[model samples]
Target: MVLSYMEGFLLGLGAAVPLGPINILIMNESVKRYKNGVIIGLGAMSSDITYLFLIMFGLMIYVNQPEILNGLSLFGGVFLIYLAYTIYKNRDTKIDIPIQQVAKKSSMKLYLKGYILTSVNPYTVGFWFSVSGYIAGKELNPFITLFGMLSAILLWITLMPYLVHRSRHKISQRVSHWISLVSSIILFGFGIMMFINLFYN
Candidate 1:
């Protein structure tokens, strides 16, 4: 049981550590407001937990169907392209908005942003599906495995915002612009690749 938990923890950590769209959003938010970044992370973590529950409980069996998978991939790809375009368009805009102005928006909005971003990501769905299937095949207790995975995800999300907050002083407008540009490019590339894969695979 301990080994099973450990394996799940490692898998969850590995998945969360990747510099995907969610991580990029968290970093961007962290530079702006540390609490907002943590809220985003919590939202992302919630999505992960939801996915794990669905996958582990056999509710995600339909995801294995090629047609359904392809549809999800298409939706995710389109969403990513839209997100990238929005980011690129705003890359040059100077954000002179006051912190007080930013504070007017509720934290729930930031949390929702994080939740929606992670929820729409087909890769995240696919990953959880695969991991759950693997765990099932190995005869591990699903509850224990999920607990481990959730623990790791929570830990990563908590630590990431704090670290980025600590380094917020080092980030400048130019640096932020570059980060946005690079992140948009990465997301665009992934979206394009996903579309391409639909034809090939």
Candidate 2:
């Protein structure tokens, strides 16, 4: 059980540390306000917890269906495209509008953005399905694995925002602009790729 937990921790880090929509949002928001990023991560984490519960109840098989995955990809792709457009459109906006106050007011919106983004992402769903299937196939302890995964993910959520928040003072206007622009392009590219994959694969 201990060994399984250790392995699960490593797996969790592997899964969460990779470049993904949630990570991008966390990093981008952290540069402006620590709480924004932390809330986003918490929201994303909530969706993951939901899937973990489904897996625990042996309902992940439904999520593995091709049609369901494809449907998620479709929605995710469209939503991502819209977000890209929104970010690019507001590229000229300044961050000096008192982020703490704005964050308090827009807390729900930001949380929903993170939760919706993760929930619609086919990759996120597929990955969880795959991981759960692997554990079941191996006859491993699901509770131990899930506990480790939760711990590692929580660690990431805490540390990542703190680090970015600390360095936010050094980031300049031009750098921030480029970050937004590049993020917009990358998100657009991801959306296009998701669409292309649906037809090709």
Candidate 3:
């Protein structure tokens, strides 16, 4: 059991460290408003927990169906495209607004954006399904495994924003603009790739 818990923790940490749309968005937000980035992480973590529950309870059998998975992928692709467009549109907007006011006004929006962005990806569901299967095969306690994973995810989200916030002074406006542009391009590419995969595979 102890070994299993440790494995779960390592697996969770590895999974959460990947470069994805959510991570990019969190980093971008953190460079501006640290609190908003943390909120976004919370939202993403919530979605991860939901996927964990679904996989543990064997609901992933339904989620793995090709038709349902394809539909989800389609939605995710479209949403990513929309997000890329939004980011590009706002790329030039100065982040001169007061942090307090921005947080108060956009907290829910940021949270929802994170949740929706993470949840819509069929790949996320598939990854959790595989991870859950591995845990089951190892005879690990589901609760322990989930707890370990959640802890890793929470730690990552919290630490990432804190680090970015601390380094905000070092990041120049031109650098920030480049980051936003690069992030938008990456998201758009991912969205296009999803569509291509859907059609070809």
Please tell me which predicted candidate would have the highest lDDT against the true structure: 3
Prediction 3 global C-alpha lDDT: 0.83
After the best TM-score superposition of candidate 3, give how far the Cα of residue 37 lies from its true spot, in angstroms.
1.0
Candidate 2: which stretches are off by over 4 Å?
96-105, 137-139
Over the stretch 37-85, how does candidate 3's per-residue lDDT look in tens digits? 8999999988888887777677878878889878877988998999888
The CA-based lDDT of model 2 is what? 0.82
Ordering by TM-score: 3, 2, 1
User: Which of the two candidates, 1 or 3, achieves a greater TM-score against the reference?
Assistant: 3
Q: Which ten residues in a row have the lowest lDDT in candidate 2?
A: 96-105
Sorted on lDDT, best first, the list reads 3, 2, 1
Which runs in model 3 stand beyond 4 Å of their true positions? 95-104
Report how far residue 68 has shifted in candidate 1, in Å.
Answer: 2.0
- What TM-score goes with each of the models? 0.83, 0.90, 0.92
**Cα displacement (Å) at residue 39, model 1:** 2.8
Across 100-200, the per-residue lDDT of candidate 1 in tens digits comes to 66543378987887787787677777788788778879998777777788889888888998898777566777887997798789879878887897878
